[model samples]
Structure formats: structure tokens, C-alpha cells
Target: MLAKVLEEPERGEFFARREDEAHSLVNLLQAILDYASLSPSLKRRFTSALIRLSSKSGRFPDCMVLEEVTRLGEDPVAAGSFGEVWKGSFYSEVIAMKVLKVYERSNVKELLKRFSAEIIIWRQLSHPNLIPFYGVYYLNASKTRICLISPWMQNGNVVQYLRREPDIERSYLMLDIARGLEYLHSGKPGIVHGDLKGENILITSSRRACLTDFGLASARDSELIMSSSTPNARVTGTLRWQAPELLNYEAENTRSTFASDVYSFGCVGYEIYSGEIPFHEVKSDYYVMQSVTRGARPPRPPLSLCQTRGLDDTLWAILQSCWLKDAAARPTAEYLVSRLRAMPRNAEEKTTPAAHGWDRLTRSRLSHSLVDHPLSCSAKVVQEWKQLSLFEDWEA
Candidate 1:
């Protein structure tokens, strides 16, 4: 099958074949590349073969390369499963260049199909809460290094921005994220942001959060290169933020759902307010998975921290609702938007020092709580299963 794909020309009948297999094709390549048992020497051989074949798979014409794309940097500023994102310029204006990793090497037919499809879909997307897609251009004469362009966000991702400016109003940011999700979920065929971690949520210059790295299985079909030791680190980070259904092996399907995204939004909320990832207290990814599968959720922030960060009871409850064990029990993104719109002001009035003290007094009397206790510590980062290829065949 691989050889058959390789024999096709850039404009041949093969590149025009079935489009839906794009994500699956990418997954097949990922399975080979991420196979842990492959020795480094053997892996390098496979990479070389892919690289050699990449040049032949090029499809876009020279005219397609945007003249406005001024400069592309040598080193990538960020990396992920899709590819490397380099800091660049579009007609002298700063921009982000999303250089995809799969197109150059992975299967040519499905990738071009996926890229063409996503380009149209991404182009049609117009929302204040989404990072707008500019255009695509070839970075080199070989046409192997194609880039998807967008505005350069100086504020960085939501997590990085919050950590740098700890005093920023978190509720406002959360609302931005919620509105973005609402826009996506409100679409004709609601776009499920399969990945919704803080890293994928960029903070615009206006200080609003905008969603990126979505579509094409949340862009899992391409390699967005990362600086991590292995690509699996991205999946590991995802595991910490995943919905219970996505983590459950007993479940027939583990594909990300709208409900799973809501659960991840809850994790992102924890990151925004507490400056920590969900299950930060747990070191082992496997253990976090184990705990979540066993009905355990991330423990709440300390009372003092919660009060300081405006994570008042109302806001905490909203976040808790997003993490409901039953997917159907979780609130929709639209519901969250409405609730968050009035949350900050109401929470402020309700969480005054006096109110905090009063809550502290009464909270102890209530035996029940909104969230579960943190799982007891048992292990650190276990090297036994360094790479989890759980999402390779994840449903679209």
C-alpha cells in the first residue's frame, strides 16, 4: 500500500483519491514512526526513506506560494503532532508559519486531500475567538516544506500568559475560551475541538484567548513538531486533560467528543486559575489514567488559593459540572458561556474576605464535596511504556 502511494505523481489520479482517509493515513505513518521497539538505526532508515519519497509527493504549483509571505525562520518556536510552527513575517507583518511534518514524507495522496479540505474549512472559519488562517506557501524550492500561515500572537498560549501575568482576570479568559468553544459547537456540523488544553489556546494581543490547532482530528493527522524528547509527550499531556470516556478502555470508542472537550475545558480552567495542569499532583501518566478510570478527579485547589484566584464556589461548581463522569451530564459549551458571562462579577461580590471566612467555617460541616480527593502517590514517571499510541486510530 505504501509503495503504491509512492508511485503516484503530484497531479496523478492517486492524489485525487478518497479524502476521508487522510487522518488514518497519517496515523499509519505515526504508528511506524512511534513504534518504540524500532532501534534508532532502523528508525533513521525509515525516516530517510520517507524523506526521499517526500520530494516526489509535492502537489501545489509554484504560483500557489504566496508572494506576501516574506520570511520563514530557521528554528521552530513551537512543535506538536502536526508539525513545527516557526515565527515568520507576512508582507512585513509578523505571522506564525505552521510547517506541517507529514505532507513532506507521509502518504502523499491522503495528505494533499486533507490539506486541501482543511484549507477550505479553515478559510471559512471567521470568529474573534479563532486564530485566522492566512494562506499556504512553499518554504523551499522543493515544495516539500509548505507552511500554513496565521497571525503571530505575542502573548503566547493561555497557560504561559497566565503564569507570566498571574493577576490577570482569569474569568474573562475563560469566557473567551468558552465563547470560542460555543462558536465551534454551534457550527452546521459542530466542530469538536478534540484537543482543548491551554497550550492549544493562544492569548491574542488584546488579551483574549483564541482556539487553534483544531480540525483534521485536531490536526493529529500531521506532525506539529515539538521540542519534547518524544512525540508521545504531547499525548501524555493530553491524557492528563482527557475526559473519562476517552480514557476508558472498556468503552467501545475512545474518539474525542464534544463532551470530552468540555471535560478538557474543565482541565484548562484548572490551569488558568491554579497555574497547574489537571492532576499536577500526580507524577505518573499511567496513574493519572488509573485514577481517572477509577472515578477519581483532580483535587480542588486549597481554599486560600481559590479565594486569591477568584475561584469562588460558583466558578468552582461550573468547572466541576464540566467534569461530570457521565458525558451527557456535562454542560454544553453554550451553557458555560452564559454562566461565565456573569460569573466574575457575581463571584467577586460573593467572595469578599468576610464571605471567605464564613465559607471556610461552614464548608467543614458539609461532608460531601463537588470533586473527588487526589489519588495517593504510588509512582513517578514510569519508563515501562514511554509512548502511548492510543490516538493513532482515534475516530474522526
Candidate 2:
């Protein structure tokens, strides 16, 4: 009977619909496996069935495979370490398509399985502050390449939006991010936005800040990012927002934690208020890593600029707490949500003129052209680049 069960195809759809029942069944099966005094052969067969069932039980309830999508242009609108984002139309509605870059020699099946695990967590999430996952579809028949679909935010990321509309209420933007983090951290295992930065925080048409990339990459993907030989675009861009613990070469606990996410949150706060990347003064990525590990933090923006941006002393203090060297000393996401919510709106920011000497800060930093910035590319050029296997050396 167990052999027959193993031979049968997994009923993913059935388990997807009855998730509670699936979980209950899993629990019952686990209990039985633990206590039942079965013969060796029967026990082995029962374990195999349980393993197969367990894998199917986590399927997304409403998994979608979008069949039709029209690319808006040839060049990608944005690029990331793992993928390039193309502006596309899906069923007459504007959407963003994140085309994942998978090398020809890569283990496609293993990568897809890992990505599917992340999607299982991503699909069930629903919040105003979170970017909505439209669905995913293969870009190729072999399923070597895939595209993730999400709504296109015309307003762009929070940093770009704030740069254009400097007078926008920054505290409210911070509140949106804090709320998003709170919601993510409230989950059972708590989803960590492993790569949180200005670029990952999109501004919706409604002008609300929504988090985009969260737990999309597995540990193996992180190894590539940390590799010295990897593209500078992937490495240095994220290093600025990374926590000290994550950057410490000597530290054994290098994995991203809730504390690390909080640290990135503070960096994001700096970017939103200052209109500059964290540690912009440091010209080199190597130095930035060294500085962070040595307990250095981004310098406080000028008091006048802070006032204009509504970043008062209290808020600055909160940001500082997030950067504390001791990970345990950092504030929780829940605490941050409450603290940001209770912050009084600064009336001075509304009436104050845009702060001076801000452009100097931009000029001072070395150009980070490789960083994921909102840049347009010609469709033809991007198409030609896509065909080059050398350009696809790594996978996300």
C-alpha cells in the first residue's frame, strides 16, 4: 500500500485547498511514525510516503502560471543581483516582470525547488505595505528561466520618489516600512527581508511605501553575493545596508537575523531622510565593510537637513539604537512599528524650504553606477545582452 502511494502523483491541488486538513494529516502521520512499533520494511515505506506528502502539503493554494505578457520595451527598467526587471503588460494591465538570470550550466531543478519554497511563503502574504505577487511563469520551454510578476509602481522606489518629491512626509513612509516589517516578523517562523534597501522599497500609485524583495534568495544565493569574484553590482550595493554582524568575517553567526533586518531598516530610514546611501562618505566597498565591522555608523545628517526631513532627535535616537553593535540590544520590529506610529508629525518640515548643500553629499560619493538605480536602457541593447551566456554567469 505504501509503495502504491509513493508511485502515485502528488495531489498538490487537493492539499493546497485543504491546508488545515493537510497540516493535521501531517501531524497525525508524524505522531504515528514516532510511536508506531512497525516492522523495518513497513517503517521505511511509511517514512517515504510521509516525506512525499510533506513536500506537497506546502504548495501555494492558488499557484498561477501567467501565459500572456507583452514586453513594453527592449531594455530592462531595473536590474538586481539575481534578475532584471522589465516593464511589461499582462492582460492589458501594466506590470513589472522580474526575469531571473539562470546560467546554462546551473542546476535548474534544484534552483526551482528552492525558489518554490520561498514562493510558498510569499504567496500567502497579503498586506497594503507589501508588494503583491501576481504569479510566476517560465520564460523558456525547458523551464531554465522564469519571470516573477508583480504590479508596476510608476512612482518608483522610496529613495527615488523622495528625491523627486523631497517635501513628501518621510515619517509616514517610515511608518509604512515599519508596518510591513511588523507584519512579516509576526509570521510563525517570521519572514526576514534578507535584502532590504532603498531599491527594494517601492512606492505605489497611492504613494504608500511597499516592501518588494523578501526571503526570495536561499543561503546558497547569499554565498554568491558574499563571494569576492561576484559582480560588483551585487556585492557593494547591498554591503552598505548590511548589519555589522553580517559583515564580520570573524563572526560565526553571519546569517541574516531579525536583528540584521532591523539594522537595514535604520539604514533605509537614513536613505529616506538624507537622500543618500548609508556611509556615502566611504568611497570604497572594502572600506565600508571595514568601517561597519569596526562599529562605525553613518554620520548624522546636518541638523538643518534633519529638521527639513522631519528627522528629529528622538527619531535619530531610534535609528541609532538599531545600529548598536550588540545584536540583542537592537529593537524588535514590533517595537519599531509602535515607536514610529507614535512619533509626532513635525510641523517645521511642511513649511521649511529644501535644505541646502544636499547636492554636495551626492557629488562627494564615488559614482555607484553598478548599483540598482532607476535607469532606462534601449530594448535592442538589453536583448543582445540577454543572449550572451557570459552575462549570465551567476544565478540568484
Candidate 3:
């Protein structure tokens, strides 16, 4: 199963929708033929069939590949909303790249504003724990891309780690995140990580984790700017991790502060210990608003959750403080990082054996990039990346 998944992850088990359920995915005929690199005749036969299918569908598998491949210097390992994230190979050295999806954008004028702002925002800060952007590149006349050739974040995300390795050093991981956030929020301009959740954070190849995706980040005074636009572009962020204010749909009509971020961060903290969706008991955003506004509080963190995860009363209290309903009661990122540093020493986790999807090749093939990979990462990310062999070099 491991070998098969690595060789043909698209057809392997554990996909959200069954193969028959998704007919539009570019067929794997060509990739299969390429993997059979030893057989020229097989490749030729597959090529003929591929050509015929492309003629009918008006798309080719290889045609979907990234163009520049320069700054990244290699092909994409994972792809997402703005573009493909390629593995960078800079003058023999390898790093990662985030390339823009040209075809995905319709309004170039609007895209330029958002894209430029995102680039400038990332450039303003630097930390060993933050996902760093090497720089931006423009190829030809209309193409633009952001290359982040930093230390590759290898463990995937914290959310998935919670479920699979619920015993991982939570205090250690949280401290790493807090320290990075402290740097971001206490800077000269004081950047507030507008979107703080599990999915956006990536664990490094070095076993160290860092916060990422500051596209929505801003300073204390401008935190409210997140919902500054009407109806907003693409809902601003993931709904499950949204604060009560955001879950209420008054985003554009009201204001947000570091307090709002605190509320959201609380949910993120729960994800660390429970390894479950912050409010999995609820159904949807409307359900969330009904429950949280009516005082539906998450369960209290247990001593076991803290002990097993290498956290303590102080750090747990701090995590919960980030999630208080009233923004005023929530701790600032700077404070959270400070308190997190006081975590108690705990043993490392004993991870369960890999799941079906986390076995090999399937582990590296993240199903859809639009699932959101910023502002910490989703709860299931590390598990999925494990299945895809994304952390091929990392031990369990």
C-alpha cells in the first residue's frame, strides 16, 4: 500500500471524494507512464491516448506546470490559492517557492493591489520561526511570483500533530509559536497576525515550528482593517477558526482588535490539546454564532492534556486567555509568547503509526491547495503531509 500510494497517490485510498466522485481531475495516465520510466513503448502508447484526451478536453497535464521555475529553480511540491509552492534549488542549494497562479486570477488590477500588499507585509518582518519570503520575481511581462527559499518547514502543521501525536511536546511547540508572534507583534510597527489558527503554522525540517501566512497580518491600530471592506474578499479567513465577532457576520459592520485575535487564538489553543476542530460540536458558522454568542464555551483543558503535551497551568491558562469571548480579556501576542516560554519540561510524544493517506506519496500530494495554508495551518495538515511523505526526512 505504501509503495502504491507513493507511485500513484491520486488513485490511492483515503481521498475525501472517491475517484468516481471526481471526474474532472486531470487523469493520471501520463504521470503513470512517466513513472514507468524504464518502458519507452508504454510511455508512447500513453502519450497517444493523452493527446487524444487533451484534444477533447482542451487541457494537457504538462501544460498545467509552472513556467518560471527559476527562483524556485524546481517544480512545485504543493500548490494553493495564489499559486504553486515549488521546491527551490538556488544555485545547487534547495529551498521552497510560492508561485502565483496566473490563470486563477481574473481581475489583474485587483490582484496586483492584494499581491503587492502581501509581499510588502511579509518583507517587513524577519524571524527564525516565521515563514520567510526570499523575494519576489517578475518573468516576461505579466507574470509575478513570491519565492520563499527559507529552511523548509518539514513536519507539516500542528493541527494534524495534535490528533496523531497528541502527545507531542505541546509546550515546546507553543513556545516556538509564541516567540515568533512576540517578534511580530512587538516590532516597531507591531504586526498583528490577523489569522491565527492551526493550518497556517508549519513545522520545520529541524523539528522546530514557525507561524506563517501574514497576508492578513497588520499592526495593533490596523487590526480592524481585516474586515474593512464590504462583503469582504473571500470571507477574509477560515470560518472554523473565526472569533465570535467574525462568526457573527458583523465583520464589515464592526471593529476588530488584538482582542479579536485573542478570541481566535483561544480556539487555536484548543486545537493544540484536543486535536479536534475547536468547535466540532457545532455544525456551521451560523451554528457557531448561535452557540458561542449564547455562551457555548469550549471544554476546560485537562491536566492530562497539559501534562502529556508538556504544558502547564501557566501556559494552558495563557492559551485559554487568547480565546476569551471579550477581546479585552485576551492576552496580547507578546504576552502570550512571554508566558509560553515558561512551559514546564515534558517528554516528547509517541506518535501512532502512519494512516492510509500519510503512508508515502499520498502524503506529499495535498488534495486541494484552497483548503487554506496560512495563519498557522489546519488541524489535519501534518497528518496529511505525513501520508504524502512530505516529511520524508523527519522521524515519527
Better of 1 and 2 by lDDT: 2
RMSD of each: 19.2, 15.8, 20.1
Give per-model TM-scores: 0.66, 0.68, 0.60
For model 2, the superposed segments whose C-alpha errors exceed 4 Å read 1-62, 215-237, 346-396
Q: Write one digit per residue (lDDT tens) for candidate 3, span 166-229.
A: 5566666666677677777666445557677888787765555677876566433232122322
Local accuracy of candidate 1 as per-residue lDDT tens digits, 1-396: 233333332424323323222222322332454343555444433332332222123222111235446666567898887778898865446778887776435564445544543453454466878887665677677656667877788889998898889887778778878988888777543455667888999887667788887533221111211111121222433788898777766655256767888999999998888888888878998999999878888778999889888899999899999989999999999999889877646366234221110112222322232111111110111111122332323232
TM-score of 3: 0.60
Best by lDDT: 2
Candidate 2 backbone clash number? 2
Using TM-score as the measure, the top candidate is: 2
Tens-place lDDT per residue, model 2, 1-396, is 223333333534322423455444344334444455766544444443343343444422222346666778879998876678999876656778888776763655444434554454454466778887666666777757777777788899998898789898888788888888888876533556677899999987767788887533222222111211111212333889998877866655356667888999999999988889998877999998889989899988998999888889999999999999999999999999888767667344335332221122321221231121111222332343335421233221
The local lDDT score (0 to 100) that residue 155 gets in candidate 1 is: 89
Weakest 10 consecutive residues, lDDT, candidate 2? Answer: 223-232
